[model samples]
Target: MRETLPILRLLSLALLAGVSLLSSVALAQEEDGLDIGEAPVIIPADPADAGTLQPSPSNPAGATPEVDGDALELDRRVRDSQPPVMKGGKISPDGEADQGINIYLRMGTPLPELPPERPFADEPDDAYGAFQRGLFLTAVDKAMPRAQLGDPAAQTLLAEIMSRGLGVKRDPKGAAFWYGQAAQGGDPAGMFKYALILMEGQVVERDKKKADDYMRRAAEAGNASAQFNWAQILVSENPGVRGLTMAMPFYEKAAEQGIADAQYALAQVYSALKDVPKEKKDRAREWMHRAARAGFDTAQLDMGLWLVNGYNGPRDYELGFRWLSIAAKRGNVVAQNRLAHLYINALGTSPNPVEAAKWYVLSRRAGLKDVGLEDFYLGLTEEQQKQAIDQANRFRRG
Candidate 1:
């Protein structure tokens, strides 16, 4: 099945739950980073014995128990809190303005980056090769010895298998143990995974301090996602200029690595910093454009507006219309509203009342009401109004 934004969000939360570390590793690979040998653990639709897994007597008191179904549901609720802004203008769930700085560009906390290639890359053929080929039981058998011998890769692979119940019973506690070992063995990915487990307090005791330390280690070890997240933490805890200054380099590093959210965050930071030179402020537009081109809908909306209004450069109505159209098609209410205005005013193209009315209706349905657009719609002839509504319905269906 094709992956949707909602599905990806759920998967991300699952990563936070420490049950899908391999999936997170695979995502890092897509960013052209280090390769952890392929082990894309698919979440089974009906995991075998999912109902039978229960917390052991050894579980820490007051720690959340991890029943397979309950864990999945809890992950879903966590994901729902950070819903994708299908119609809302906000960039992310956590985004908000503070001290006159617009910090809505950064998304949620970052996940771990893929650790550097394991030193035993060539030697682990039996275990990794078997895991990659779907022989989960065989892979586990081969990996166990190396894992016991303190191989980070082997330990991580075992963690992945145990967490997902691949050819074995699901064992989140066992997964947590292996992940901790892998982290201690100097694996950046393991540090990230183990950190998340510690933070969640499921299967392992909650230790916010320990989690922060592990996250810092992962970030310093060159995990781009970790760098972005750690930067966010630092900025949040220290909202002063000094704090932002400290976070800047990490954001820059992550942005340089092609993290679009990081690029958006940097753009906001540069744009909002007081007393910055004009050239420096203009750099915000550059990063915004980069992020927009990389598929960040919020940046696309901002870029379109900036281009249309000549905020940081000469006005380019045609280019602005293009960007606005791209975001509008992606269901951005603000973009749709702006696209309607552009159509009505013939800013980039010939005025088309029908198209304008269609966009206005769509935007209005998404909770953006423009009085002028409403008046214009009311003045349209009955036939034109009917045609506009039909077009709006078609767009809605698409």
Candidate 2:
């Protein structure tokens, strides 16, 4: 399972003055199962136990014939089963009955034959390259030969192309098989992709336990996407499970690997959990800063808020306004609303009705629904307000 770092950590500047505490947590287990900074372990979510789980096809609705109490009792008796293990002289040292009991040998079973190595060079021409070059059929054809030869890379590419309908009709089942083959060959990307299908219940039955297993395998193999996915699952605050405090390590790991989305997610997590200790806030701010620097829209918005309000540090309105403006211009409704609020209240900027009206109109058009801006503009003369509203509407429409 993935682990997360503390998003709400506060640290004294005296201790962190010179050094940049830009450390990121990795998804892998170190020593004890706990993540960085001695955060307690948080168990990941079980896909099968979730409310969203769908009934298996084998147990399809109305498939099971109803029976009277007597008939059910008779059926139960007929289907009664016993545990495979038995205690007594048949029991092994590890407990339970031993299936590998060997009277002829002192040790356990012999090892299997080593399989022949298939070099990476045996992979077919890059299907992604061909696809990028707009040669869908050619890429698929080239991948088929390597797929037949059991090259995991080719199999994965073939699966991706088919699933995405890059060159042919979308075939999720076909994609699933190819992904499974590549995963069996130890390709992390294949495992990740295949696990996504299982998790999403696409073209096949959803199996959360299987999906979690595959995701874990891929994450352990250093697949950034898998690591991120596993971390997201483990970092949730679902009922019967501890909060995301335990998932920070995995988030940090994926973020450290330079996954833009992970960075953005970590930043958000930290900002939301800012109520933790001062050290936690500092840690959260660190992640937010990293994500903001990387140009993540959410991170930019959050970092801007932090800077403008001095939530975790000294106020820096210029920096905050810059980041907010960036997010706003990029179509972030929240950022636009925040900017309008600043304009209206003069909290982090000078009060300018025209500018405030512009931000309010932009925010409103972006689905923010800021009624206050409309009210404020209505106080002016009809002609002035009309001009302002028309300008704002034009900007919003644009």
Candidate 3:
């Protein structure tokens, strides 16, 4: 509701299918409200026999939507791979924190800056080798000498180790200092880390101008995270298509480097920008599909709807249904709600009153309240309603 006029003027999801119009959502929610839409108008199977769910005559039973070879390959890829771009510090499937970044952080005041260099000789397997093998303390010891000698790489290693607290106490202040040093010495990693620290203003004095400089430098140096984040920052600084246009190249570069978030951004860019070339607009399909396969649940939700409604190309209800089912299983509440619609309408698979109600129940449990689904559930027979409830209760998100 607080969105700017420029964002409101941009293309909305309504252009895709039955989705409502919404301005370009902000990035803070991590793509929330970017793809999901309300349920389409539900045409009863037969007005005369409203109790039974049936496909509308226009959709036709046994509608054999053509199978796409590219889609088949995409299915194979998404089905086979684990999530491609897990952020550091997030818990994994097994609920263990990613030892990658979080393990290194200990929330405390920064240690005092190191004294002048001691006579410690460096080795081929110096700080980096030890750090890679999880020897955080040793890495710090080895890196200190070279860092004091103004080696950017060694400074970067110390910064990372100190920031992550890799087998050592987290020294945010020390990390900030080393990160700043490494950035000054032209290390991309240091630039990106230091830029973030500067932005946060907690670990050091807040310096937005310096943060932007380091972020831009790191992005130009081809750090994928830096590229995606820099694009987001650009969009934030200059809203609307003008901002998006300026950010496109960086988004593309990041996407090409396998950043799922960037791929999703490009998909939005092409879809929302009306003046884009036909070929470029068409790339939206590829980008959306790629992002979905990379475990971006929002992309997966949109790809399903796009395929279902032929927004990208031919309507393939079956493929859309499969994708929606996948996202629903992955605990996307919007996907769950839409999957319920698919079940009731028999868009992709055979309809079961129980399934439609069950999906609605699951989505409702997640706090995605849908009045349409409420009515649909209310209309079910009591016996069927009980079955739906049982199924919903038994179901667990995969």
Candidate 4:
């Protein structure tokens, strides 16, 4: 009995040791939620490595036989395939992130690389290329040398840059100087710019005569804007035949270049001159139509009225209505009044009293006093008036 008792005591101790080991292992697994066996060693890859793996700095030999708890948790979360939570913070309804925390935690360990730097200009042509590409600083760098060397195009470009402060500080005086230099070099654009500077008198001295001279030079050089301005200068003192004859050629040159203002001016000249020939009036109508088509609101209104009244051309109500409608849409009050007239009379389109009332009210609101339009509006039924009021409200809101 004594021998059997000893053997039982040893068996009890052995069982206790086995149970203790198992409890320890179970506790570890509960904490880590990893395998019971020793975790396989993991190596992190070098930054430059193509595919080789090496040991992670966080995990080392003999630290723990179990997998890392955080790593295991991350793995489990990944394996469960749940939608990723917005790490570190939440996004508010206003499209802002929570101010208390960094919302970029989900971006992992490393940040993305930055974008490449913008290229700088290396040469004169490169400067122009950069300027064309909107790299104004690069343009200035490349053109500075050439401008200093008296290159007219480069000087003009620098002048533009200084005037507009493109990729540099604004210097109107410097721009004027550069423009003067370019003009002296016989650059037409430079002459035009310098003429404006001279006229403004803010950057340089006010010299209208010098400005006129430069403008004339620019006009002679075939600059469209210069030609228009020069013609105006010549005729400012004299609107008689001699002045007209002097300016006519320049005006024609500018008009042929698609200058809307010049076209309108030419039309006015032909139409207003007393005792002008029928051919001149016809040319006036043609020029007015050209300006109208170019979206000049005044020209549109004049052309519309002329066409409707059979002045300078045959009466074409349809064409008149189109021009008036275009001008009205551009908020020309005169055009709106005319359009309302056309609408009420069904001249070119079906008569719509509601539309006419709407336009009449709009024009009246803009301080246009039209007795006929007021009478027409007063004649509309209550429902039609209400609809017109609603349309006016929409138009006003817009």
Candidate 5:
């Protein structure tokens, strides 16, 4: 019996590895409610509760969440189930009512991830290595001799340095010249930048045909940004499920290369298109989770509701609450409002009126009005209100 006891102990320890485990033990645990915990709490989506969320409140944002923004206007019933619409180069929510379905263009703020600057990607020579180390001036000096001798890779290095004004006066025209030379020399990064310059017309000339050619070439050559943009162009030109089908490959490519925007777009393609296969639709949640984890706030917001409403799979209210909390912390107004709902209703957490009010206060200050949140505030005690305000103030100071 003692000898057999050690064998059992060893077997139990081996089960912890998960692979080649004892099925009987697993079955026992399953029957006893083990696994990744029980099936999550689910809130069914009522289709009748659609197209009623009033996003974009008229009031300009205040410095901090206020007890009162304007008159008590309570257009606060949030809903899902709105179809996606192709509008103005964006796959937007059909009515701007699905709080998380609105996909904004990655514009105005420049994405720092564009134009790969890895010193070791190809030429790990001193010049490229110098650029990697923030020695931009040194990079230019070492790269110039090679650049003058018509080295396209070196030319690309010079273009990136000049364009970003890393260590020298910003000379976009000079960068354009270098980029053009590199493009001619068959550099994918150079081609992508040159294509953008041509399209912008301000940096060079607005030759869209030429720009399109260059972009296509760059995309085919495997520039992640070019791949994503090329997909957008295909959608804009074709404008339907056919266009989406054509562009899916490029979006997949870009998403695989860690482009968060591309990941979110892929999710939208799967979810918004009714013609998508059930297997492919299942991928929407996966891609959305990727985008959200990559810090795309909108994706995070959507992931929260999707999990709660079981849009893609079974509900997991705990994870949904977590994602919504993350977006709320990052200052997503809609998330803040929705998170308040979660908190007050005890969807994924214990009902804490104070925490709910705190989140609502943040959203209200950001120019979003929620009548339900207002009523929630009115119901809180004066002490709870002060505590909520204080909590919000701490978040503000940070």
Candidate 6:
């Protein structure tokens, strides 16, 4: 046995890796090391087992002996509404993503007053619009004249053309100068683009602080993308640090404005905050569905899992399978594996061995080789395996 110990360790390592890969298929639940076969087991807490309830703090003298049903309901409500706090995508119920930043802000005795508002650029001749519509060379010729006249839009557009070598020579410093001119003129889009360039520090000098300030300004002006990006910088994934809670409000505002990515993030936040009130589940589902409908792949996969698991709503396998199929087709490995599980287990919908096999092959192609390949291979007949191989070969050619 001692001589064979090394071989056993290697086998154990391989098994652990395989299980980890397979576990990625299912929605993570407490105590059940992630399996496609099970749902979350909600254990109800019985008042009788909980012992005598304390009297309400409001009326301490005259107390009903029975459990405080109102208090119980209130606690339950809170559990339902709370959003899952996350930082850098780690799962934590609390929103503690930016602990360091929060501490720094707290330690600082004084906060500076915001800088003066930047002014908007004067509208250029319709040439910028024509350029945006892809009439490049024509717009460039027209924009050059307006740029010389100090039209901020023309300057910015001219900069864009020059930077991309679009109907003109690629000029880095020249582009930076124009971008700076437009940004100083208070164009929100120009500010965002300028901030990006400054952050990269290629064409212009690196200025992290200035970049953050510019992003904040653009976000304050209700730029949805800017809000999302700025919020992302505030969150952290490490445990004990503040998570998405710091970014939640911004994400919510952006989501309300119909930003698909923001909506998706909001949904994920709610999903992670399991301690939140159940009422918030409806809102989470709404945001997730909206993002999924907009072709957001991550949201599609999440919503599909929710449908499969009956989280925050009813369990509808047909709908679940439909959405999962869509996500799988779009190359989400998790979705592919989940789809395979559904097909093999006949979960939520009727099973089709052939469809299951196809998805399994696709999952393998996506670099997810777990129970998906093993299960599908077990389900297929020899002829079906041949057909799958033939289809895969044909797909490779195309």
Which is the leading candidate under lDDT? 3
Model 4 C-alpha lDDT per residue in residues 280-383, reported as the tens digit of each score = 76798899899888777767877776666655667787897888888888877777887888888787779999999988888899888788789889888999
TM-score of each: 0.63, 0.60, 0.69, 0.63, 0.65, 0.63
lDDT of 1 at 203: 76
- Per-residue lDDT over 183-234 for candidate 2, one digit per residue giving the tens place of the 0 to 100 score: 7666777887778778768566888888889988887877776676676666
Q: Give per-residue CA lDDT, model 1, range 171-269, as digits (tens).
A: 787788878877877666667668778867867888979988987897788766666666666665565565566777777877887767667667766
Pick the winner on lDDT between candidates 3 and 4: 3
Looking at model 3, which ten-residue stretch has the lowest summed lDDT? 46-55
lDDT of 3 by residue, 1-398 (tens): 01011221122221221111211221112222123343332211110100111111111122222322221111111111233334673667775557755434554545457699777463354567666555556666777666666677776777666666556556677777777877877777678778878877896898989988998998898767677667767776666667788888888988897777678778877867767789888898899899889777777877787777666566688899999999889888788898998888888899888999999999898788888889999999999999999999988877
Q: Between candidates 2 and 4, name the one with more favorable lDDT.
A: 4
Q: Which model, 4 or 6, shows the larger lDDT?
A: 4
Evaluated against the true structure, the overall lDDT of model 4 is: 0.63
Ranking by lDDT: 3, 5, 1, 4, 6, 2
> lDDT of each structure?
0.63, 0.57, 0.66, 0.63, 0.65, 0.58
What is candidate 5's lDDT per residue for 1-398, written digit by digit as tens?
00011112222222112211221132123321112211211211110100111111111222321112211121222222233454544453444443322333244554346586657443246777677656677777777666656666776787777777666766777788877877776677778778878877886777889888988998798877778777767766665677777878887888887777678778867765667788887898899899898777767877886676655667777898999899889887777888888888788899999999999998899888888789989999999999999999889421
Q: Write out the backbone clash pairs for model 4.
A: 43-54, 43-55, 44-54, 44-55
Stretches of candidate 4 off by over 4 Å are 1-130, 240-242, 274-281, 396-398
lDDT of 1: 0.63
Q: Which scores higher on TM-score, 1 or 2?
A: 1
lDDT of 2 at 285: 67
Prediction RMSDs, each to the true structure: 18.7, 22.0, 21.3, 38.2, 24.2, 25.1
**How many clashes show up in model 3?**
3
- In candidate 3, stretches whose alpha carbon ends up further than 4 angstroms from where it belongs are 1-125
What TM-score does prediction 1 earn?
Answer: 0.63
